[model samples]
Target chain A: MSLPLIKRERIFAAVLIIPCILFITVFAFYPIGYSFYLSLHRIILSLPEIGQPFVGLENYRALLHDKVAMHSLINTFLFVFISTFFELLFGLVIALVINRQFKGRGFVRAAVLIPWAIPTVVSSQMWRFIFNDKYGLFNFILFGTDVSSYKAWLAEPVFAFLAIIITDVWKTSCFAALLILAGLQTIPDELYEAARIDGASAWQQFRKITLPLLKPALLVALLFRTMDAFRVFDLVFVMTQGGPADSTNVLQFYGYKKIFTEGLMGYGSTISVLVFLISFAVAMLYIRFIGTKLFKETA
Target chain B: MNRLAFYIVTTLVIFFSLLPFLWFVDTSLKTEIEVTAIPPVLLPSGTLHFYRSSIENYNLLHYVKNSIIVAGSVTVITISISIFTGYAVARLRLKYKGLIMGALLMVSMFPQISIAGPVWRILQSLGWLNSYQGLILPYVTLTLPLGVWIMASFFKELPSELEDSAKIDGCSHTQTLFKIMVPLAAPGVFTAAILVFIYAWNEFFFALLIMTQQEFQTLPVGIALFQGQYTLPWGEIAAASTVATIPLVLLVLLFQRRIVRGLSAGAIKG
Candidate 1:
């Protein structure tokens, strides 16, 4: 009777998970498999004349030589690498500042979420307005002239890229701070107090106690931000549309243009595969970190 | 002086985070003249010019309704699925526990663009293009993993002894879940619901991709496509965006702790 009861519970658990697994499979897993399948064929939705053909690695080979894809790939990596580094640095300062007890701390924490809470489309558009050459806020702040002497921030490659980076840092640094702040909170206060009792300076305390304990959280924040940043699209789409000769085009946006705009399904799938590979590489890095740490801790 | 430095840093953080939206809000209130005027209007022009016109001339409210319907359905469906699956994972003695979590995490990392072609094809096959269900299905899939992660963490935190007591008191497993566990995990549910709702509301890519019909277009999609041939009515857009974001900002302010806790748990644990 006891064995049956346990078996019944196990059956219930299996039944409960079926719906969740089914939805995920239909919408998530199936699409990934189908996308890969699509990537191998020369399927152009726009050109029925071409017909679908088995292309195998041709799309992948083309992607290697394609200038736009290569540029976008490089741009995606550069953007993620640079922006993530700065975001981490800025977020660390922010987390440290807010981690202390202070008046209006709650307000500060709440207000800090405003940028992150605003939708990516909205924030990107807002930044676009702010970076508008003629009558924008950035121009007003930097120029303050009645004459037309402001730089077209979104029209030039470097400036446009910089504009995107600034908007991204603004939108995401709060997310970084929130994650880091959560990590900081997990560091027991007594450790800092103990270090203080030993006459450790504030810097010394942070270096010895906070940094070591905060490693996991810091890694999580870095991992999350870097992955999302590499797949940057909406911001680029709404703001620059990967403009100024595709200088600002990241891989995701490049793929969107191919699939949606150009209607090159197979080529687009290749770009998507490229994006997937980059993201997979990042995930692999995170996994290796986790694998080593797990081994060490359990050992 | 140390406290002074702290306050200064605090104020800077708040100011930087809040100023972009504040600048847009200021633009929203100004007349078209002030909005375009050089040496740009630093303050509100005390006119509800764009707000009034955008609501009257443009169907701003229509997009809001579409967003509400789509996002609301998504939250209901996703939270329902997530709670059940989360409960299963948290309580059941299941093999392949690591595999399930790993699969979900790996699935989450698949670039949305990577799935764009297949998802579009599937929607086309189902004849769900430009429909509410078209957007909600994919939205649920994208948001479900985080939901499950949050709820499962919360469920794992509760003492199993409570479940045992409920069992002895003549509660069926389902009844125990509803009467005892759901109430305790209500915070997790609420957190997950708020997050899923926000995600569904603010998602632009899939919304833009799937909802082509004006009537079906959500807020982000509608506002994004709200430009004229030669001119963009920045004032009108700013007004609409502010109106849309106000409720979200308020929700975040009111339940900042829950949002933070839910997000950190999903992310840090992953």
Candidate 2:
């Protein structure tokens, strides 16, 4: 008896999904496929050349030996791993602190988001100035002796990388905290109450009950941050332009430079395709491990 | 003992979170002399010169207007398109539903920088370079995937019975979407709007690559240019940054819960 209605509703659902299908096909899937196509051929803009030669995976071969591409790939992974780790750690602490009953918790929670809300470019610029060697506040505060002798923060390799990481961590930790805090709020107070009744200490209860329950949210937060950190561009570009010696160059910036600055469109496309692959791999892993459970639960 | 330790840690964390901003405000209020004073002045000596001078010299208001215009338009367009498209995906049992959803999610993962070169060339040929449409359209495209995903989750949470009941009342699909689904999904809509607004407002690469003219520049680009031009004008830069940041700060503060919920909603669900 219900078969006919179920079938009809299924048909209706199909009808409803058509627009998104069309939109994604045209804008999303097409561009990705086109990018791969572009990567296989040599493209020259100056001489008005499009697909001059079918290079047949030669671009990928060249990218393997490309020093800048290799360096950027390593840096991208480093940035993602290090920043994501710290963001999760700091975010966990902040979430735990704010989740407790305390005076002005609301204000502190709100205040924390200020860094997250400020445009990355704006914050990068703000931090860039603070890192300035001459009359820069960071040098003034840290050294307390000579403001003029401060290192060019964006010039040196190590400092520049550290500076970008600091900016990223600052901007994104609040976001991680917000997500973890939401996860914390979902656990019933009775769980904690029950744990307390069994003589469980705060740390013990947190370790046993809270951590396990928060696994889904924690994984989701990690996945989001990992993907985002890998594709980092705006702050790095604005802060350093992959300078004072290409120290802060990540894969995305490297790809942009290849296409726009070098005009090697094919090579640039290859780099982008690699970035897409890396991110796609991460996304797939996340879905397989964490997203599957989330979807199953919701469905 | 526990309360004291908690307070101490909380205070330090808050201070660490806020020190950059405090330094920014402090720098903005100091004079050139004070800014470069041999021994730095942590506290301003009640000098309003730098702030006043920055306002008079730089068209901070104009940049603010341009940012508001770009961010506002992008948010409106992205949200509108996502509502219809997201509803379709979430509610409609369309063919290849999994494939469509997967494709959209994959697109969101693609780095914008990867396409910047080709996109730049395309926009140039179309004469969209230096135009608001040029910036807004790509920005919308960039934000749409996440927007759709978030909105879809919102729509999915909604029971289909309500839409069915509305349809049984002689309302067409479009009518049910507008009359029943949209109203029910208002919170999600607001959440999507806030996230899109933040992304568009903070977007730097497209603005930097496409909009070359200063007058047409968004706030981020304008600040970048300001940084490059005034190498030593930390005070002015800080003032401008503070000006640029105040609105977003206020928005986050005012809608703290909504923003948090929105972020968590997207992450936990999508």
Candidate 3:
């Protein structure tokens, strides 16, 4: 390519790229910066006549003392940790199954992806009904027409939380499986063949070879699933509404209620900032372990 | 693994994955009385009553129309912008390609709450709240990262010689992109479009905040905000959910391979 043509190409490329950058900056980057600025002031939408006032770190301080906020933070952390653990475990198992050559493999893969394909709000409603006291499949399965023996699952604090977690695990495990399955595809068949030739049992082969090779993909899945699990609003919003004594109140849902519902814009922005920072920290930690191989490949 | 064990595990995985949603589908088909039967009846009477009621009473078609408009617009816009972005990063000699790619990955990681309040305000100021464009703009922004990554990966795999030859034959970059590279990259474009559509169709948070008006809500938001008179409308909710999900179910069945490829393509590259 000639020098002037190369210049033309670069200009054309810039033209192609600028729109995306502008869109993202305006909608995503600017909003984040604006959110931070909003967090530093006291702006109550309901009490507009009071006027906006600089609160410095007043909202952050208030967040520390807010019992409901603290409780929600704890609940969010628990949901992230527990739901991620089960999703990965189930994901690994599903990945292993689908990776095998079997009859109806395509059907099985499609079937496994159905939950993931459905909207979260829809799934939440489905689970909510399942946990219903009177007309629930859960009660029918456990108590089996023993009408008086049925229990209200969502009415209790602990079970409501558990219900949300179960709903999440059901919906997302297949996504984790797909990522892990990609990792599985990259592993050489020779390694497994050699292990079997050396008289290694299936369990031994998985522990020694499969687990080691699957680490990078597992880390990728972990990073994404954890970030998503932290933002657990739709499930809590639909399934329980952070209810049964606020047992399912997650940080995202709590922040949502604070800002949109109660019009506590300043304090809600603070909560949003906290969620962002925590998710960022987790992503950074995972990226360190996964290494800059990701950056290198994309570049 | 033993054959019996393999079959058992497979059955259980499929059962667990499909049961909850299938239960909802079953519920959608039941008679209003059968829906609430204690020790809930496994076999539905297979009536379309709830579907009729949801559409008639809840204005389900209004929500569906809004979802199609929003998700369709987002996909078209995102895919168009991403094609340019992806091509630039993949084939062009950009000075800061790595930096741009990294920024996109960062954007993908951002929590929706972090941007929700300001985005709402931005739309409000522009007089776009409760409007289609308000929701579509953010949806496009959010889905762009995935679109760019998928398209870029696709573009990278194509032979540079093709573009080089086209250039040698006196073709400009724009002509080559449209006539040659795009048709060749049709699969990637299609994959990105599918994923983006699914995302926009399913997004709840921003839609909930931005489209608070009953007329503007998408299917997900509308189904979520469903209200009942005396008791919670389980039957109608189930019906609306089934109606909302059938297209996605059909999508999954038709394009399972492409959807799987797009998802993993976005992840493994990172």
Say which candidate scores most in DockQ.
3
The numbered model that scores best in TM-score is 3
Which pairs clash inside model 2?
A13-B92, A13-B93, A13-B94, A14-B93, A14-B94
Q: Report fnat, model 1.
A: 0.60
What tens digits encode model 1's per-residue C-alpha lDDT throughout B58-139?
A: 7899989999999999999999988888888888766566666766777777778978888998998999989999999999
Write candidate 1's Cα lDDT for A189-248 as tens digits.
898888889999988988899888888888888878887897788889988899899989
Model 1 accuracy (lDDT, Cα): 0.85
Write candidate 2's Cα lDDT for B84-197 as tens digits. Answer: 778877777555556665666666776776566656766788898988988887788778876887888899899989988897887866788899999999989998998899
lDDT of 1 at B64: 90
A123-171 per-residue lDDT for model 3 (tens digits): 9999999989999999999999899989999989999999999999999
* Overall local distance difference test of candidate 2: 0.80
Give the interface RMSD values of the models in order: 3.1, 2.8, 1.3
Q: Is candidate 1 or candidate 2 better by DockQ?
A: 1
